[model samples]
Target chain A: MNFALTSFRKDLSRWRQDLMQTAIWFAIPLTVGGLITMLMSGDGAQPHGVLLIADQDESFLSVLIAGAYSAGDIGELISVEKTTVEEGTERVNAGEASGLLIIPAGFGDAFLDAEPVTLTLKTNPAQTILPGIITDVTEIVLDAGFYAHQLFGEEINTIQSLVDESNDAAVAAIAVAIQNKIEVVAPQLFPPVINVEIVGPPATDVQVSLALLYLPGIIMMAVMFSSNGLASDFWVERDHGTLRRLVYSPGQLGSFVIGKALAAAVVIAIIGGLTLVLGFLYHGVSWAKFPSSLVWVALSGVALFSWFAALQMLFSNQNTASVISSMLLFPLLMAGGSFFPLAVLPGWIAAIGRLSPNGFVVDKLTSEITEVGAWIIDVNSWLIVAAAAASGLSICAWRLRSGFAQA
Target chain B: MLKVDELTKNYGDLVAVDQISFEAGKGTVFGLLGPNGAGKSTAINCISGLLRPTSGHASVAGHDVVSDGKAARQNLGVVPQELALYEDLPAIENLRYWGKAYGLRGAELDSRVSEVLDTIGLVDRAKDLPKEFSGGMKRRLNFGCGIVHKPPVILLDEPTVGVDPQSRARLFDMVEAARDAGACVLYTTHYMEEAERLCDSLAIIDNGKLIAKGTVNELRAKLSARDVLQLNGTFPLDETRQAVDTLIERDDLDLEVITQEEECVTLTLSRASQHLPDIFAVISNAGGVVTETILRSPNLETLFLLLTGKELRE
Candidate 1:
């Protein structure tokens, strides 16, 4: 018992001091990475807005126009306010209002005589939704104004003139008449809204495809990139003759190698899990089912650590490890859905994703949150990953014990 | 007992150590004397279990270097020609580490370390980094590190190289104390005078061969020359030198002039105790004035020159 403890303590102290720099090396990058992810999570801003308008035409037709435009909840998004035409155009241009309408003098006389009249309407061209909305509301308001004129017969113009001496009843009537004409030509532009309902219980709220599709590839890439420290540590120890000393220590060669692999596993698990938590906290990923999600992630970390150890040992130098890790990393990233949506990726890439460990882990986690995938969690694939890990450990052990450590 | 039996080592076609052997008993100082590349270092390396021999065997305190490497290593302490102290570490820390390597622990290791530091005359500077030390201090620390574990046999490989005369003298004293502590010491050096002054018995190896091995007097007796001869001088006479050289060079005398310096000349006559009358006859006939005459014994330098036919330093 004393012998084992002494040996373990010696190894722990040496390994800790030797790899202190490497830990800081990895931790700084991971922390900065989490910060950057937190800072850049969503699109620029929310897309909803409001438009306010004012109308001063006080005729009964004008009142009818206001009632028509404010006829439904649609106007809740477009409010009317009292103001002059110039003020209204400035407001519309400044984005405070959507549009402005002005009625000429003698508009009541023209409407009573059944004469033509011109109504000036100013539209804001910069707003894609507001201009169209303003046009639609104007047509509705004018159509109602014309209907009110017809219902009042001769008294419509007289009542409008009494309410506002300069009210443009003819312009309002003509605007509604034009909308009525366009109703024959462009009825679909203002089609009635349809209410939607489902026949059964509703499905989940968040789309599984959105998060699961990219996360697997991201995780895999992260695993490969973050495991650089392990490989770097191997090269560092070899250069420093620390590995030689450890190998010469009695009964420690095997355990030392195992300890290296375990250390890599712990580091990868920590950084990978941190990435997941940051994803949840900042990206708003529903990690309510975090327990099982964390399990697959931990397994992914083990598999990655194993692969990295074997591959690093196989590599002759740091440049070789970096190039190989990245080559395998980015391809898995592209396939497993990190950079772009999986739906847009080529079929072959998605097929490759089917074999990717990251894809498997992410798909497993995503399945608990939303049900949009057909990905199967095959036990055989996991077995294959485990077998790969075993083979890697064996190769690393052999190389470390014999090839480089023959002395 | 430390025995090197007919040990041979080769680096490719070059024979670093030819078949050679020697033995050192406990508490004895066995000096390995040689010129540069005369295989002194190679033989010591084999004895210390650092280099394996191509043939023959070496043992430390009866433990075979090859078959019982750990035990053999445990029995021997080696101070290599190059200082092996870690430069960044303090002297005591270096001593402690080596002590641990030798399986010493706790208060035992601490006491041994302190004792070694005191013996090496570095007790005051034990806490200082070796790199900050003078060449002499570093060499002392190197010696301390090697002997801190108290192995049964200690190998000193050119321990005084690049050291000041004062430090070298102090180090020699320390080595003598090591011998007094009951450890067999195998000392190797090119400085013939050092070996002559300190070695209990000496081995003079040349060209990978042991040319001579014995006490200084015994080895000096191998040449056909008396150990020492008297010289009488008067006013630095050339005739006196010529007369002595002539007598010593004659086949019947078998005597040789060893030194002629500053109004006097010294000679080692072959069978001088028997041929003293003949030497006086020549000195008297040369009209040389005899001021003084005295006889003294020969030392290892004369013996080394006789055996190797070259100066030890050369």
Candidate 2:
């Protein structure tokens, strides 16, 4: 009767009675959250492309033009196999490609006579944002090609006329003539160009990274705050006169405090872990990095549990607990970067983040996943977590001891 | 045994419990009878160690209430007038919670909870919530919660105050059972009848002090020299009653009298009913004839009025 062990046991029993409800509370949120994230992340189904091309004449120039955009980001720009209008419709209907392009036989003759020309492009409506980007790039690339042909065609005509008349250009004269022709003929527009070179594998694998880091870390913090509310089982005891009896019994106050904290930690870890794991499942996030992620998740949970004990003791009742919890939770969640990425916050806000266990845990998760190339294996993050854990435990212990003494 | 010796409490500008003292022996029920604001609850709180006395001391089974509170409390059970129970929890759950708080666990705790539930005759409604219980049922659970640990010293503060007649009787039975189980019971109530029916010994408190303390009969004996005489008859409506009053006005006799519509007269005489024959003879000679005359024995209520100059209920 005197031991807090009784309190812990009772808490466990009550939780067991409501185990199904607890699991549901956890499952519903995680499932909904994961689905929301997926839907919001946009349809990741597959990449579909429409290729458009305008070749003005059936000559070597058209062949060379057809050869230029033959691979990768360039090849995907043109639907070369679907030349006719009917073939284009079939290919698009089959979902094999987005659209097709065609050039008239007289296209090169009109361009040689300096006649105006334009090209057409078709796009897929179902694919929302990316199609526009592909269209704009195709227009600029084609225009540059047209101007280059016009400049080179003039230079070739001038050289043929000079050779038939037997004119001496000199080794120096020939060089001067060719240099004048090249200066007038190269493409005029610099195009404000953006050349993206893929130096290594693109980091499109960010989904799992963000999920592995964020899901566990945030869920851990939330569960810790919640458990503090639940762990104040003493409120129930006081009403029952069980507390009075214990205060008179031979139980150690310290042991009771320890038992309460330990039980809370265990409960939070289990609940938080289950939510995160199931959330990952719903999000279809791979767990190849589970081993590393689990370590940080557990640390975060224990740290949160420690802090919660201190907060919970500051309250005399459930209403007070709720008020204090919000007071702490909002600020902690904000500073800890649970709502937004830390880098986006102002300096002052980031400085506040330095004081939050959430911030420390988030930073640890980020480092493990993103590999921001820390000089150490995240020494600063680990130190912050350790400090937070220590402070929380000490405060909890001090408060509980004083509470007993005063009682 | 529970002993409170010279218990005193002060609340800055007022004295709540002013040097009151009493003892409760094994298998005995001691009542602290007083009107509201008479320091009954303050004294009970001090005895239960819920409040610290300004001076003096209270103990349970040789353990100091303050210094050895845990041990003292181990033997103590308190049933407050307010139903201090969790409404959200079922009756059995509430009982189990209190049982655990008393350090009962696992199978042992379960059995004790069942036993206490049965003691209050609430075994059938054990799984129901206190909120759903009748006023009487809730009162029983309140009692059960306190006695679940089977402490040797039980403090019940007006336990039957708001209960129905049935629950009230059950509560009294439970109190008697606790005493029979060797609990030293300190029962407080403002209802004189409750105290009379349940307490082995009683103390009357007025304005934070013990005005009287003894067994009901012993306290009643304090009024042994006085008698309450009731006379009913057709009086001579006028001069005959005046003559009787004039005859009874002598300083040698101590008497107090009041009349009801002149049809019945009650006389308080500082003598036994043995003198009733002479009293009735005087009335008959005055033509204020008595159809019926009765002299009743003094009781605790008379003793209370004699000592405090006010009724216990008042």
Candidate 3:
């Protein structure tokens, strides 16, 4: 154990001397995460799409269609601007808006009478995601209008004239009739016979920033690069002939393996801490959750470092080991959500990625950072990460004990 | 004290070291001399517990290399053929690390590190990394790292392969000092002069087998009855062969062809000085022109060539 500590100190000093390699390990993740955050953050404080509404109908229903996009959560995502047909067309063509919603002159009457009428939605070709979102929201509004007309066509028609004329008595009579109809139909809409209740915790409106979603993946990338650097030391020592000399020492080989792992863990912890601090300061990461999340990050790094260390032991040539490890690294990063958010991945791919070690640990860290008290309360993620780390270290120890890496 | 009893290491069908046996007592430098690809390193590795012998036993300070590996290693220090010092670390730190590995700690470790630095003549530059030092300084540090614990049995494998004369001289003194202080040193080298100067007893290995073993004079005694005579210049192969045959038949000359090349012919003969005139006349009569004729005394180089039919550095 004493020898292991000595070796660890020596390795730490050596790593410190290699300032460029150490700096690159930390810089890669920060730079990648920063660029991703900048790209995903969009051009404003809030991520919103510009939507132009051309109400050619000039009717109450047309007004309602325009109001639908300007209210609620969808309203936060879209900024609605009323314009003429010529102006809406020009804006969409000029790439000034995500999309233009044109309501035809007979849209209100046709929609109220349950007659088929088309609402033209022209999206800017230059915009992909935001324009698609605008088209989707417009479809929802048209669906809701069709369903309302189908369910209460007569009552809506009776109120339509009253709404247009702006007469007090007529409006009051129409309101009374609508209230009577709603009283008779409200029970059917909800269904007294079969009641649906949401059982989980109430949905909370948590405003997760792009940085929050991307930070964990970036941190995991940093861990991978750091672990790669650390694991490469085994080959470096072998090449330098220090490892061969150390084999003749009275100290157990297991001690050397443990010492190397300990040094790697220390470096990983420092890297994790630095990234987390940066996340907190520049990316709005929760300061209160930093300690727990950093622990997971460091553990993840150790797990990966041990795994690569085992590979280093198994392969005799350093170049072969390095090439294979690097080849494996990129796929792990891609599947582990280092390149992009897992939420954006296909469902099957995301499920597989979440089961991967990096993905699992990153998931735990992200949860810890996004939800207060999550890391402490979450037992399963901790166990999984612990199991991975234990398995990796176990393989490394067994290989080292066999003197497979002493070449 | 170190002892190797019929140490054999085989890699599948290839025998790297075959039943090689030798011993080095306290205060003696035992040299293992061989060309590249010989089993010198394999034997050293087996004795140092770096490799497990296939069919023989090795012990350091009475502890078996395989059975009592840890205890055996405690009594052994190994200077590998390669520079084993960490290039990024200072000489002192490298010594400190190796010292701790040998079970020294605290003040004892620090003092031992200082002593080794002083012994290697690098105390003044102890804080400098190996990369910042000259090749000779690095070689010295590499030697110091192995002996930091002052183990009784030390294995030096070609420690002066590329060292400068001054550093090589300094290392020779250090080795002598270690032996005088009661360390049994097992050294391997391609340089026959180094072996001739430093080793008390020598083992010449070839093709994974020990071909010769004894003190320098004892090995030289094998060739005391004969001397090597060389005739260099353009020589016809048929004429050289005829000359060698004619010399072999002469009653006054006891001569045999050692080697015959396109431009030179070497012969081993008894009483070379007394027979040189007749030997040169035989070559001249066979129409072989000799530009230079040289006679050499018996030495390790000649002994190696006579035994293995090759140079020690081949």
Candidate 4:
């Protein structure tokens, strides 16, 4: 064994002894992944909404239209509440409910008399998807009412007219007329209701894909954090005087850096591998991508650690190095689609994130995680990672040997 | 064997080590004696290849420290003033790490690590981290880490600094053991007793210059058997100078003034115990009262004071 290998073995032993630190580094991103998953309401989650109806008509037609929501599968997503127009308007305006429905005072009579009357829906602008669903249901109800008027307008008008005259005989005669109208139109109006089908179970429900969407970025965040930890170890070595001891040794300081980077790669690959395995099992990542994914992940770890180590060596003061490295980590995590999905982030943020050190790799890993991927794609990514690791670690080694520390 | 010739290091305006030179062969312990800010560390650093000398050069086992750093460093071992062991690692692992660093391998590396653990008396605590060890144990581990590869040339910079008497004794024994193994040891320390007890030959450096160089007895001989004499009382500066003028001029007396204060005066001369009464009579005649009198035989401590006109600890 030579000094480089010696350094590697030493760091490995140190990491083993300080298991809690490694565990925390690995645990943090997973914990963040879980919390963000809950926050984004993934795992087949459905958000419930409130619907307030203000019916001034208090008539049969108006009540029937409002009752339709409670009677259908749409009932699962929305709760129906009856209120006065003033209260309903206040609730919708306050964003306390999804939407408010207002039926005009003469709406029932106008519909029965084959006249036009308005049914107004006031949707909460603050609400996005739920208000739109409510609007769609309302439109369907209106279309059904219009077609019923076209089909049975004469019979309905006779029933309304007969109720005011000699009640028993007129009611019987109107019933027979409605029966005759239904028979005449029955063949042509087979299945009058429009059949709307949901493509899949995701009806306003956030699913596992939403959570998995952030996995690659968050996994990269974990890699960066581990790299940061690895870089700080150099500071410790410098402070403890072991680094000064290395100066007296015959080995090149470059070997020490290479050794430490190797250790970081191992730790990072394990994290990336385990997370990718979970992705493979439940999130549609192919098993065939594992080997390449592992190699890419480990290489990315070395690149990230090397860059962080370069940042550490850039300063003469250890405190400055520490502050700068810590400061660099979170912005990368935030902009790189680790904290929030790139699709949801503002355009400028996503652009900056994609340009960040770790963000491009994150984007590549997540682009088509559900589809089967090549062993590794985009040769430029490999070159970038390789170049970054080489240049950054080379800088660190050069600085270390160039009188940064005196023996 | 290790050799340094005109080794000089400059920090722009400050010369940390200037034109100092010496050589120590196998089985000899050469000591660099100086107080704080004496450039001892700079000189040793240059010799160990940890620092580049501004001009001049050094070599370890015949390899140039500058132009041939790796080869020179391979033959050299450094135990710095600071405890440089990895506190997170067990003592055995620390030994192994440094052993392998010097290019030891396979069975040889294991044997050397085990030997060092036993030699440092950490065999029982081999699996324990340095952080859990006592101050003395950690210091021993520090020493063990340096010599684990058994380099031909070793530099021990203030190895016994801040240690208890027992630990200091253990360190002295370790240095003697390495010397017996035919290693050329270059030890640096300010403690007069350690230099006298452990060093076979040494140099006294101050302000980046070597002031004196010889064996323990040889350097003491520079004092010419002049025992130091001290008198505590009120004495005028001019009167004290006038009082010692006569004896200073006499070659037989071999007298010299070490230091003079308002109420105290120290002087060194041959057989000062025999000349004390006469000295007291002369000071009395000069209107100076000797309230207390003390006399000591010559040693390196006194010689350093004689040569540098300052106390050894100063």
- Model 1 DockQ class: incorrect
TM-scores of chain A across candidates: 0.65, 0.64, 0.67, 0.70
iRMS of each prediction:
6.2, 4.0, 1.1, 1.2
lDDT of each residue in B82-201, candidate 2, tens digit only: 777766668898788677666677898888898898899998998887878899998899889888888888999989887899999899999999888888899999988888888999
For model 4, state the Cα shift of residue A264 in Å.
1.2
Q: Show the colliding residue pairs in model 4.
A: none
Q: Residues A1-407, candidate 4, lDDT per residue (tens digit)?
A: 25667678789888888878888888888788768766654446588899999989988778888898787679999999999999999999999999999998999898987787888999999989999999999999999989988877876677656655778877777678778887988878676788898686423212336777887787887788888888878778888889899889886688888888878788888877776776566555566667877788789888888889878877888899989888888888888888887867889988898898888878777653533455545788889889999998898888788877562
Lowest-lDDT window of 10 residues in candidate 1 chain B? Answer: B227-236
Predicted chain B of candidate 4, TM-score versus the true chain B: 0.95
Best by TM-score: 4
User: Candidate 1: lDDT of A17?
Assistant: 47
Better of 1 and 2 by lDDT: 2
Residue-level error in angstroms, candidate 1, position A132: 16
TM-score of each: 0.53, 0.71, 0.81, 0.84
**Which candidate has the highest DockQ of all?**
3
State how far residue B124 of model 3 sits from its true place (Å): 1.4
lDDT of 3 by residue, A331-357 (tens): 989998889767678999988898887
Ranking by DockQ: 3, 4, 2, 1
Q: Taking the candidates in order, what DockQ does each have?
A: 0.07, 0.24, 0.72, 0.62
Candidate lDDT scores, in order, read 0.67, 0.68, 0.85, 0.85
* DockQ of candidate 2 against the true complex: 0.24
What RMSD, rounded to one decimal, does every model reach? 10.9, 8.3, 5.6, 5.9
